[model samples]
Target: MFWLPLLIVAWVATGLSCTRLCLTAYRAARPGATPGQGHELTLYEAAFLSGGPTRVTDLTLVSMARARRLLLAHTGWATVVDPVGGDDMERSVLGAIGPGGQSPIAPVRRAAAGTDAMRALADRLVTAGLALPEGTWSGVAGAVRQVRAAAAAVIALGAVALLMPAQESRGEAHVALWFTLALALNAGCLAVARFEIHPYPRWASPAGQLLLSALPARGGSDLTAVAVRGTRALSDPELRAAFAHQDTAHRSH
Candidate 1:
């Protein structure tokens, strides 16, 4: 019975240590943010370029053609003067690209940006189920930095809590304290990587503009105009729906 408190302390300490270690390792493996991040054109970019917003039915063949041109331009490839006839762009001379797809071009390889403020640009593309085919890590360094910062903050807070004189008198408190710290650290790391850091600026602006422009135009006139002049292009049904929804919702509000 005398060992009960000691056992609890040990269990908590072990759990905390293991959890913190695992969390740290997992976060470390994650692709974080870096500096000088850029991206190729995508289907969503096509939609935005062709028109401001569009509905499901608006994505006709002409719209797609315009998107193709924009995509080629944005990617620094020879602009497609005319629309590609068939659906499959992957097998074309430009090389295959789709949602979460990669490019054969080395420079376009996915990499992280420098700041936490810009990480969301890539995050949006990633969440949209799109990426460069090669899966190169960009923006990861920045993301790592942000994650480290948050994790350190959490750890520091835990340290401070443990150092409090009032808390020291309690038995098994050290284990509980560490466990709390570990959890906080893990949460902070995740929060920083997923939310804080991103590839584009947080606000809608030039950086955001260029990144968004990379998406293939699948929507309407506003996006089509851009697509007609971009370097690369792609098309996706779901992304069109999302843009349409966002536009409609914005209009309603």
Candidate 2:
């Protein structure tokens, strides 16, 4: 009897939390009544939507290096070969590179992501419904972890109930078994969440993802494709290495 209230409260609270988050994310992703404008997202926009600002930054660096406007050294430093930016995004990338036209690529990336222009681009993408709301992925992931932790807590509560000094009763045994049911339900919730989120991109809205997938694959003659497609798509080992090293340095933090 003592443990019943505890078990009911814990399971109910966790269930409600998970359900609410799942519903909110789903509603946010669902297409609107009027539908999207079917706008063709540019490569940089696609990269930003799919992988966030980091992907766009990497693509920009790679594109500049390929065009001989920037020298991406084996040592991970980016030296600007061209001080004149052709457009606003290029100017932002160049500015992030610095007035001296040389700095470590990692810092350039951080600086670029923080730029006012970059923030504006992000706002445009969200307004167009091409990008996920900021923090959605992390929030969903956190909810999953919270539910799993609640499952564990429920088990602990059940164990404590079983170990308490009391007259042996079927009612007490039922309460513990009920905890097992709660654990099983938690497992089901986790499975569903995983399935739902696996196809959901980190920064792109579901509509954006669909369009990105339907876009023509990068071709040999598409100069713009290389920048938007990302550094991983590059054939140059050194360029990929520079980006890889930067990625590693970030992960270590």
Candidate 3:
């Protein structure tokens, strides 16, 4: 009777906590997944793509770095760029990387001041490559759907706990105790829900970036070169036409 309800509450709490933590980790493992953008890094866990030497040669990473630098160069240092584009871009980019719109100064005290600043800066740079939403209604709708579903489930589970009477209610103040328990359970669920909707601020460490850098396996892995080459590749109409022609020719054959 009471034991079952108590057990259910405990079980639900445990499961919810685990779920929240998993969501947090999902956002954390990616060096650049931001909250506002709703896109997080998915692959590259453990060893970050196996079957490769100590060399770094992932075409995706190369393209990411290059694209980021190009955006940054056009935007200028974090402070001097255009008010609208720079601010919006940085906020969106950093938010996607789990920084949650936090200023560079927040993560500083966690480590040596110098190291923390460097790490924050590196994290910011890496974040430039993250693709998050541009704050559109569709983006909001998606986020709302997820948050609402999670929150509704939590609330419904908490309601079930209240509906079930505890055996211990046979004693004095039983009703009060039951209500208190219900409140606590409900609060716990809500808190977890809030955390899921709005995660704590954290960012990737420079070491993480360096580790990713080591994972690549090709030359021109540097962001600058990647940006230059990738941009040229995209913008050159002649090159695109040539490739399109070649592709057509190959298909015909």
Query: Order of all candidates by lDDT, from best down to worst?
Result: 2, 1, 3
Give all candidates' CA lDDT scores: 0.38, 0.73, 0.34
TM-score of 2: 0.86
Tell me the lDDT of model 3 at 105. 17
Instruction: Report the C-alpha lDDT of model 1 over 102-198, residue by residue, as the tens digit.
Output: 3322222111122222233335544433322112332344444544554555455555444444433454475456546555555655555455334
Model 2: how far is 27 from its true place, Å?
A: 3.9
| Between candidates 1 and 2, the lDDT winner | 2
- What 10-residue stretch in candidate 1 is worst by lDDT? 106-115
Tell me how far candidate 2 lies from the true structure as C-alpha RMSD in angstroms: 2.8
Error of 3 at 147 (Å): 13
Top candidate, metric TM-score: 2
lDDT of 2 by residue, 98-211 (tens): 888788888888888988777887888877777777777777766777777877887887788777654446766676677888878877777776677665456777766777
